[model samples]
Target: MGEILLPLLILCPLAASMIVSVSAGRMGACAIGTVACTGVGISAVISIILSITLLSGPPAGVLQVTLWPWMHIAGFSADIAFMLDRVSMVMILVVTIVGLLIHVYAAGYMRDDPGIARFFGCMTLFVAAMLVLVLASDLLCLFIGWEGVGLCSYLLIGFWYNDPANTAAARKAFYMTRMGDVALLCGLLLLATATGSLRIGAVLAAVTNGQLAPSGVNLAALFILVGALAKSAQIPFQTWLPDAMAGPTPTSALIHAATMVTAGIYLIARLHDLFAMATPIMALTAILGTLTLLMGACTALVQSDLKRILAWSTISQLGYMFLALGCGVWQAALFHLMTHAFFKALLFLTAGAVIMRTGHEQDIFRLGGLRHAMPGLSAAFAVGASALAGLPLVTAGFYSKEMILSGVWHVHFGLTREWTLSGHPLWGIALLGAFLTALYIFRCVFIVFCGKKQGTSATGRTSRLMSIPLGCLCFLSLCGGVIEMPDTLPPLHLFSTLLDPKTPLSHADEPIWLVLAGALAPLAGLGVAWVLWGRATPVMHEIPGQAAIIRLARTGWGMDALYDRVFVQPFRLLTWLTHHDVLAHAITATGRLTQAVSGRIFQARTGFLDILSIWGSRGTGWMAYLLGQLDNGRVRWYAAWIAGGLCAGLAMAVLS
Candidate 1:
């Protein structure tokens, strides 16, 4: 039953995608959307049933099914297998349920577009790939889905390929993520070589039992970490994400906000045991995550475009998840990942509605006093913003964020007691990021929805299809974190215990002040936002002659410009220098010389064939004579000659 169901879960959406692709020009938008949604809806139902069965069966319950052998070469093997444990259950639910909602919303969001069929086709295919990524039991098999999402992302991000900027954004995303993919492939090879298998269980067991050298473990972990960083858009690789807003809003919601960007977190958490043994890499992860969190928050604070703000916010939120993983509180990271998906998806979808109705106006400063005109949308946006800001006690973001903060505060990593890395500084930075998160997101909310009407006026009302998903996500954004609470709240470790029964997450002995600090950071940020932009006369437009620091923050601290000068300029220079094909010319010269030499040689070879034939006949006669010497009358010599002839014949047959 599990085997049949597991394959069905992937095949449903995959088959739908194929159908849509093959019948694209012949199908109407409604038919396309219905087919896409129905496929995901069925997968969602299967995921729920699987989740219920896993939870009800046992603490260590897992449903694994191998449909067939994926590959077998020499000493290497992999299987087309699926595994549904607690971690995957959470991921599948997020991928399918959130993915379905986005599809439903996209139906209305893209209703009038001519390429609606293509959009649905890529969207459905993306969901199927994500499902494969989360469910695979073998690392090699997981990579198939890993690359699958990347390809789908490229296609969807460049869906409107007529626009040069859109295609450029797509290419940029592809190239940058490919860098990390290369590193990830190297890491997987290292693990496979050491463990002699790519199965997740075997890899983890080998690492835990000291089958790999210390250096090997660290290098593998480090390589995988680099891949995750690029995928998740951590610092130094984050420029592509903001530009990714060139895609459609639902694309942003599905790929950037909910699923694809979180692939790194999932990969790391899935191999937590391997990471645990590499403490230095763990520290590096935590440090890099902290820097990205702070940088993304600061960059988001000054963005005027609506989607770019959310893009940076997604980067920042993922940093929090990475920080938790680094601190060894993976459950906290996964919890935040779930909640972030809900609110972030809600925000993107709601923003899409606002953009569509307001004549596609994306500049927040140019739009104002929208709450009175679109009360429901304004309300939904507020819910998403509050959850993103972690407004205490009421929002899902607060609980998950609090879990991360608590986990960071108590974490200690080092080679020795005196040289240990403490989490106190990281906790402080995260809190600061929290305040900035509230300030930036609420700043957008206030400037867009709180004051007098200004630039672009509302044009159309949001359709029921888009509104329904908004309402569902709004509810989820506020209530999804109840399954995990802090020490100060009613004790509930449902999320932690469900993920791992042996060591359920707890912050029981921590002081009460930590929770209070986490709760206050966002509240204070909200108060500050109200003072700045939430007034009757809101600060809606960009100020003239902005300070240098303000300009820097707005430009993502000039990281793109720096990268261009440091990397892009040098490469372009090299390309230009080689544009005339000097090496190719040199090779061409050599080829011409060879051609001339061969021409002369051919002219002199008129009788060479006959001479070569005579030499070959003589050589053959000599070899036959030597073989004839083995025909001595002794039975032993004859038997040996026969066996040699048979072995030579068998070798030729096999080779042929």
Candidate 2:
């Protein structure tokens, strides 16, 4: 069953996609979509079962399914193989389950579109690509899946290609991620060249066992990190994500929140053995994660577009995962990744439901009091938001996020030197970031659901199809916390035994004060938000310098403008020079030279006619004079001359 399960996990969706493409127009869009989604749900169930089985079985045993020999050279070979272990199992489970929910939701969300079949096809392809990425046994196999997902993202983001903005957004996502892809390819080549194996297990063992040099390993790791950063939309590469929101909301939920963006964290965690070689790179990852988290949180605070806000928040949450990885707490990072997938997907889907109801209005100020209209959706959104804000112990977000902060604290103060810059400071940043997270999330929740319906006459309701997923996810968001609780803290964590089997949580004595600080940060942020925006305050719209701040936040801290001035404009100018001045001028000059030569040749042909006419007239005059002399008043001579001239004209006409 294990051998059969891995390939079926990938093949099922791909086969369904092909069927949908062929039958969708005839069977109707909804029917085709339903079948595809049903297939995905089945795959999800299989993936979950596989994960449970793997967790219950031997930790070292890997289930490998080899499709074919991908490549063979003199000294190297690569295979299209899928390896199912603990890490890959976890990721596959997340992708398929969340993916199934999104697909079902999209059935209703995109019911009216003429291109619904295309949408389902693209989604199926995306699921297959992500599954391949997670299950890939070698770096080459993984890259194929990586590029595949990127392609799917571009297609989906530009689904409404008639909209120029959507097209540009898709292009931006493609190009930016391509840059990272190149880096990843280079890193993979380096690994293959150095270690002669792209298999994750082999490469990790080689690095961990000190068979590879620390410097070379770190460089390769850095190159890989570049790809992870771009694909995951970390700092400098993050601007693409906001633009990516130009895609349909369903695409947004799947790509940004659920699967694709989380790939970076997965990559780092999967290759933890390689990363452990270079402490500096790990520290950099932590710092970058911290900075990204702060930037995303601060940016989210100002975004008015509901999707854009979620986009930034996704980037922020991903940063926390990286932070956890940076601190050498792989389990914590993976835990957060799981919890985040649940809540974030829930938030985006619920937002989509609200948008669909309100005729696609995403502005929070223009939306309000949805709680009464969409009770289930409202409840789901609230649950998700609570988790997002890491509110208490009710949601998955609290446990996972708490675990991350706890890991940072333990590694920073407990395990490392106190005065080290990379140590305690990361913990401090994590705590501060948690506070900001609470503030913006509560603000979003309050504005969208708590107040009077903004510019509305009545409440808008969601459909049963939409409400079901939200309800399910809301339950998951609440109960998912039980999967990752520290043994010292709780008894219900099913996942506690699955990770770090060699070292139990009981051995890592984490300080209570650190836990208190992490917990308190979100509480503080929530309190501030309630005080500022929860009620019908007198200064609600009369905020001091609110206009400037709101404008700044809405503009994403002027990062886009800065990028335009610093990068886009310069690039445009260079392109203009290269295309217009260099290539264009060369082509234009060559064209003119050809035209001039052709014109001279044409002039030579016309000159031949003038010369011929001059000669012909002179010759004709001589002949006519001689004929007159010979004629001697005879009409025969004149007749002869006329006949000769007529014969000459006939010959000339034939020649011409």
Candidate 3:
């Protein structure tokens, strides 16, 4: 039964989405919601069953299902094949489970909106695309899924296309990711040229057999890294994500927490061996991850909007995953990715509840004293924030983030003798980012739910549908880390061990002192936040010299402006030249050349024609005068003239 359902997992949601679109007008809101939930629910069930089957066997187990030959041209061929490997199995369950929950939440969140059908359709399509991306057996199939999700993101982000801001945001997200997509395609072509394989299994198999050259693998990994970074919204490619909150909160959870943003991590994880083949690329990736982690944490500190804060937090957490991958501890990265998904979804949903309750007010400065108004959701928010802050041993984030920091600590210690040494800057940046993450999150918590309410606010109750998922996610956020216990005492390392201790996992065995520092870092951050903002009211403006600093953080370190001036503006100029300058000038020049040639032809015709006409009239007059003279019939004169004329005519005739 599991085998029968594994292949249809992606299709279930897709089919349901299509049915909803067709029946949207005929169906009521409840019916449409039911259809959407049912489809996702079915896929989630299949994922669980298939996971059980694989988990029951050896961790090496993989379920490969081939639908048909998708393409065959010359030597290059591919199938619509899916692989349920251990890593992909994790992704499948994560996408479906988290995705189904988000869909249910969206049903309640967007209940009153008339465009519910459009939202649900796009949501399910995204779900389908993500599942395919994670499960794809070949680069060709993965690209298909990759493109599908990009399209869906554009549609869903601009779900409220009436607003120009939303449209612009949708365009930003689409075009920004498009740059990485182009690089990704180029990398795929290069990989295919080097190895002549599109199937990931064959590619990895070739790597295992030591068939690929080092330089080619490194180049391929670099280009793919650019795509991953852009898709996952890391560093320079991260500008679009915060703006993407112009979409609804459910969309935020869907894109940021669980599905689209994690694609980069999954891609790197999927091609784990290829990246491992080139250590320099991994180091470079680690550097990017560390810098982005701090960048996000810094910017998140000053953000006023609740969703934007979470958005930046998502960026920071994703950087940790990237850091882990770069350090060659992909198991830690994957664990963090899973745990981050849960808490982030919970946080976003709870924030959505707050916004709904307070008349869609998202500004932390304006919202306050919500601890009493929405006690249930407020408690839920606290759970999520605690998990995100990575405070101590109780939360899921503590274990996962500590795993990443543990890897960083090991790297630092390996480079320098002392564990506390600052020789390796990534270790320092990651730890500091952890502290800032806690401070900023709790700061928002203190300002919103703990401070005084600014004014009269509306009240909207959260439905049981929304409440139930929040409760489940809240429980999971608190306890999910137990899956892989840290080694302060007897630890399980269950998540790491399940991936097998043959390669990277064996070294990731229960990190020691790093967990201790990581544990304290968040506690200190929370303490500072409590002291500073716990009793203080929100301020309207920045303090004199602090304005510049605040502006820098608010502008995401001016990355957007830099990209605009560097890439977007330059590209726009080139486009303008093509349409309005270069192309037009070429056509205008061709016309001028034709006109010049015509003017020379006109000169040759008209000027010489006038001269010839004058000469022709003069010659006719001379002939008439000679004819008149010949007719005069003067005896002697006529005889002499006639003889002269005959001699001249005979001489001319002979010469001729």
Candidate 4:
């Protein structure tokens, strides 16, 4: 039963998609949508049970169910197999539950679209792909799932294919991710070549046992990091994520915010042991994460579109998770990933509801005072905002974010002697990033939900199904921490027994003052936001340099413009030169040369009959004339004429 269950989890959604596609018009689309979502929900529940049973029982604590031998070589083999363990359990739970909520939300959200059946089918396929990705026992299987999710994202993002911007955004997302996928493939190749296995467990064992060369391991880790960075939309590769908001809001909720984007973090956590071997690469991860964290927060502050703001925030939050992993806190990163899924999805869905009610207007500047008109939406969004802002005891964001910060501090202070490298001072940078995170988060909250209504009121009311998920997510945002937080403070430790079965809690001692400072940074940012934008007569107008600072923060610190000048423009120029100067010149030159040769050959052919007639008159005509003379019975005279004609013809030709 267990062996069959794993395969069932993946196949159910795929089968549902096929059924929906075949019966699109005949069957009621809504009914098909419902059945597909329900199947996914059932699969998700089964995965949870399986994960729990495995986590509770064994030392290896993994269920490996192989369906077939996918590929094999001299020393490498990959199978269509499912692996159930603690990490996969976390991913499967998040993917299914949140995915189900989004599916339900989409039922209403996308009801009016003519392609509802197609949308639902794609969504089901997406869920199945993500499930396969999270549960795959080997790298090859994971890559298949990885590319599958990428394909689904492209489809859903361009669901409204008529919209040029939507299509463009979809292409950008796909191509940019493909860039990362290339790197990931290279990484897989290197891993297989070095360790002679694609199986996750075997690869990890080899890495841990020092069987693989250090250089090969480092390169493989870095190549994998490149893929993770691009897929997750970290620094330099992050531009596509903002444009991806052109997709349907539910897609933004499920793929951009909740599920798909988190795959990068999941990859890092899943391969923590291998990554741990490369200290320099891990340091680079921390640096990149910090840069992206700050970059995202700055960009979010200035975004007028509600979804764009959330998109940037998603990027920022993902940065924090990466930071956690980079700092050697895999568990903490996963914890944050879980919490983020709940809150971010809630925020995006609530934002969707608001947008739908307002006739698709998304500008935060035009929106205000929704607390009175849509109390449920306002409340739900507020809960999500609180969680995002890391407000005290308000939501899961605080606990999860706190865990990540603690991990950063531990890394900064060289607390983990086992993993310490260059001893870079990241505590201050991480602290500043946290501060910016709170400021922008609360800034969005205050502008969109707390202020006076700046624009027209919402025309339609939010549906009950829409509000139900929001309510559940709101409640979870507030209390989800209780299930995830540590038992004590200062030296906070996780209480997730499922995560650490043997220890259940790993405590590290740190300075009390450092811990207090770390805890207070988010609070300080919240205060700053309140003073700057919370009040009627805000500090933005009062302070001398405040306006400029706000403007800079809003403009994403001019990073976009910098990127345009440095990377985008250069690439564009190279493309132009290659196309116009090199390829076009070669093609045009070839055409012109061919035309010139043809013109000369055609001119030479023009007098061909004249030349042929001249030659015939000189030789054959003279001979015929002399023969006619001979036949006339003047034989001696004809012979004399023939010789005279021949001599005359030869003399004439020589003179000419």
Candidate 5:
């Protein structure tokens, strides 16, 4: 059952992609969409079934299905295999279920577009690749899927290739992610070389037994961390994501919600053991995650566009997940990953609906009082915002985020033999980030849906296909946290227990005030949001240097400008300066020399052959002339010539 279902989970969507692509010209939009939705729908069903089987049997259970030998050369080996442990089970469920809903919503979202088949084809292929990424038991096999999703993102982001900006955005995403991918590939090679195998279990066991050197472990972990950082859009590499909104909104939801960005978090969480040994790298991970979290929240706070706000929010949420991974709380990171998927997907789909209905308007400032025109959508957006803001115990994000905060609060890093770093400061920064998250997201909500109408009227009602997923996600966003509650609440370790039966996601004993503080931060943010933008004719205040601050945040702290000057400009200048370098000219000169020599050889050969042909033809012409003279005579001449030939033959024979 495991073998059959595991392969089917991936093949379903892959087959749909092939079908949609081949029959795109012949099939109608409805048929293409149905094929796409049904493929992901089946995968979702399979995930649920696998979940039930795994949960009903054992807490520490894993289901593996090896399809075939992927590679085996000398002392190295890998497999084209799938594994469904607690971690991957959660991932698959999120990918398939959320992906299926997104597909259904896209069916309506992109219905009127002419390239429906191409859209669904890429969507299904993306899902399949993500499944392979989550399910792969071999590192090398996982890299295949890693590159697969990258390719799909480029395709989907540039789906509307007629637009130059769209194509440029797609190229940006490709190039930036590829930068990280090259590092990731290098890290995997290092691990494979060290472990002599690319199997996840084998590599982890080797790390656990101290078979690999300490330096090797540190270098490998550092390399992998860089890759994850770039893929997840952490500091220095996050610029591409905000611009990635140039694609259709569904693509945004899929990429931000459950697939491409989360791959980094998943990779780190999956290999927690290897990272645990590299304490410095782990601390670096924490520091970077904290920085990225704050950066994303601040940038999101000032963004006017709806999708870009969500894009930054995703970067921030992923930062929390990475922070947890750094703190040796992999379970908490994964918990947030799951809950984040639900609400983020919901928010993007709802935003798409709003944009579609309101003449494709994305500015929050331009869209106001939508509660009157779109009550259902307004409620949907509010629910998603509350979850994104982690507005206390009512939302799933609160539980997951609380778990991460609690873990952060207890973290103690030993930077040196004489110095130790406390988690309190990191916790404070994270708390501040949490407040900003609530403020920015709720700010969008209040400005777009709560205040007086800004003359932007809803043009059409939300489609049933879109509405259904919204309702389901809304319910999940509010209730999914019940499976894993804080120590202050009822003891529910279902999520942690599923991952490891003996471990209950433990945290050191801390004061109750920490939990209270964590819960209060988001509430404070919400209150401030209401005060600023919740009323009709909201007050707009200006303070000294406020404009400068807003400008900086709005432009993502000028990271893009800095990168352009430092990286892009210099690279462009180099290319322009070396457009025709001396080396290139030298190579061209060598090629010309070879061409000249070959031409001379060819001419000489042609002349010699011509001379031989002329001599041969003249010799044949002389023989023909002699024969013509002989035949010109009468029969007496012919008989005389014959008698002369016979006498000459007899004389020659006697002489011989």
Candidate 6:
């Protein structure tokens, strides 16, 4: 019963996508939307039922359900299998439930568009691919879903291909993620070579028991880390995400915000053994996460475009998850991932409604006083923003974020003992980032949703489909953290024990001072926002900053420009040189000579005989051999051979 029911979590949505895709032209918009929603809805309902059953029963450390043999090549073999336990159960519930809401929301969001069927099909495919990604028990099977997600993202992001810019942005996203995929594939290959199996369990078991070489383990972990960083849109790979707003709103909510972008964090959490073996890489991950969070927060502070600001915020928030992973608090990272998904999805969808109302204007400074006109939406935004800002115990983000801050404050393992009293520099960065996160988000919230109406918006309000999901997400965002309260103030750390039982969390019972600091960070930033932008008349022009620094933050600290200078320009120059180089000139000269010879040969009458002989016989090689034999000096012999050959050829033709 479990075997049949489990893989269906992936198959059901995939089947729905195929159905809608094949019958696209014939199906009405309503039919298409129904099929898409039913596909994902069924999967979500099944997952919830399964999760409830599993939690109520005895705790199974992990359930490896093998479906069929998938790959057998050389010395490598892997099954189309799924590992079902509490850890993955958490991810599946988030993906399917939130994914379903976005699908329903998209139907109303894209109702009037003629390409509604295409949108539904692609969105359903995205959900299916994500399901496969999470449920996969082996690295090889996981990669299939990984690449599937990148493919679906490309198709959906470029759904509006009429605009060249949208297509360009889509291409950017696909290629950027692909770079990471390549690194991940290499890591998988190395793991296969080292462990002699692509099964996740075998590889992890090998790593856990010290069966694999230390050097191989380090290299494999590093390569996989590169892939995760890129997929999760951390730091350098992050530029593509902000530009990805060129897609429709639901696309943003599903692929970027709620699901695909979190794949990296999932990868790290799933393979904690491999990462634990390579402490150096995990240590570096700490630095990367700290710098990335600050980078995102600072960048988000200056952006006026609502989506771009959210995009940067996502980059920063993902940094927090990594920071927790680096601290070896796997459950904390996973907890933050779930809470972030709920609020972030709500934020993006609510922003979508606002975009729809204001004629798709995303610049927060350009719009004002939406609180009175759209009270429900304004209320939703307030909920999302408060959760995002980590407003104490009332919001899910507050609890999850405090756990991470506790991890950082203790200087867990990676930092030197000298800094134990004050904590690591990374902790300071994360703390500063926490403040900036609150400041930037609330700043935008006050500027856009408050004061007098700046410009007129469309008459239609957010639909029931959109509002219902937003309301549900708002509730989740506020209360979701109750499942994993801090050890000092919890019923029990049930979420942690089930999600990551092996490694006890060091920061579970955080110091009172640290908890107080985490509680105050958001308040401090909010106070700053309230003073700077809340009470003051909203200005469309600029906040307090010189031209240079504001421009730097707005341009993502010029990371793209720097890349263009350091990588892009040099690459283009090399391509140009190679195209017109000496080797190319020589090839061109040889091509001219061959063309001349062919022209002269075809002009002669005897050339026709040579062409016929070449065609009728084997090829140019056989014709050359025949020409070589023409030097035989007996005229009668040659004439007799030719006459007999012609007679035989004529007889063959007549028979045919």
Cα lDDT, all candidates: 0.93, 0.84, 0.86, 0.82, 0.89, 0.86
For every model shown, the clashing-pair count is: 0, 0, 0, 0, 0, 0
lDDT for model 1, on a 0 to 1 scale?
Answer: 0.93
The alpha-carbon deviation from the true structure for residue 170 of candidate 2, after best TM-score superposition, in angstroms, is 0.6
Q: Residue 473 error for model 6, in Å? A: 0.5
Query: Residue-wise lDDT of candidate 5 within 1-656, one digit each (tens)?
Result: 87799899999999999999999889988889899999999999999998998888766778999999977899899999999898899899999998988898888888889999999999999999999999999998898899999999999889999999999999888989999999988899999888899899999999999999999999999989989988899987998899888889999999766678999999999999999999899899998999999999988888889999999999999999989998888999999999999899989989999998889999887898888889998998899899988988899999899999999988898868998888888899999999999998988999888877776788978888788888999999899888988777776788887777787885546567887888899999998888888866566422123688878888888888998898789988888768958678888999999999999999999999999999999999999998888788499988987899999999999999
Query: For every candidate structure, what is the RMSD over all alpha carbons to the true structure, in angstroms?
Result: 16.6, 12.5, 6.5, 8.2, 14.3, 14.6
- How well does each candidate superpose onto the true structure, as a TM-score? 0.88, 0.86, 0.87, 0.85, 0.88, 0.86
Best prediction by lDDT: 1
Clashing pairs in 2: none
lDDT of 1 by residue, 225-343 (tens): 99999999997799889999998999999999999999999999999999999999999999999999999998888888999999999999999999999999999999999999999
List where candidate 1 sits over 4 angstroms from the true fold.
Answer: 538-545, 574-579, 582-656
- lDDT score for residue 516 of model 4: 63
Error of 2 at 163 (Å): 0.9
Q: Report the candidate with higher TM-score, 4 versus 6.
A: 6
Ten contiguous residues minimizing lDDT sum, candidate 5? 537-546
List the lowest-lDDT window of 10 residues for candidate 6: 414-423
What order do candidates take by lDDT, descending? 1, 5, 3, 6, 2, 4
Local error of candidate 5 at residue 386 (angstroms) = 0.4
Worst 10 residues of 3 by lDDT: 412-421
Residue lDDT tens for model 3, 1-656: 65568778988999989998887778778888999999999999999999888889775888888889987877577888888878888888889998988888888988889989888988998999999999999988999999999898899889999999999999999999999999999988887776677899888777667777877888889999999998999987999999999898999998867789999999998898998887778888898999999989988988888999999999999999999998877899999999998999999999998898888888888987888888998899999999999988789999888778777766632222443223257888899998999999999888888887778474968899899889888988999988886666456778887765455343345456666788899999998888777766443222133678778889788888898898889999999897777978889999999999999999999999999999999999999998997788679988897899999999999999
TM-score of 6: 0.86
Off by over 4 Å in 6: 414-423, 501-509, 536-541, 570-583, 589-656
TM-score of 3: 0.87
Per-residue accuracy of model 6 over 1-656 as CA lDDT, tens digit each? 56667888888899999998899789888888889999999999989887877777676556568889987888889888897788789999999999998888988899888888888888888888998889899899999889999999898889999999999889888888988999999999999988889887788999999987878888998899899999999977888899888989999988998899999999999998888888777777777888899999998998889999899999999999988887667778898999999999999999999999888888886788888888898899889999999999899999889878877777555334453223367777888898999999998888888755686654587889778889899999998888766656754566777765665464545667777788899999999888777875533335656789887888888888987898778988989888779678889999999999988877885878888887877777787888888867989988998999999999999999
Pairs that clash in candidate 5: none
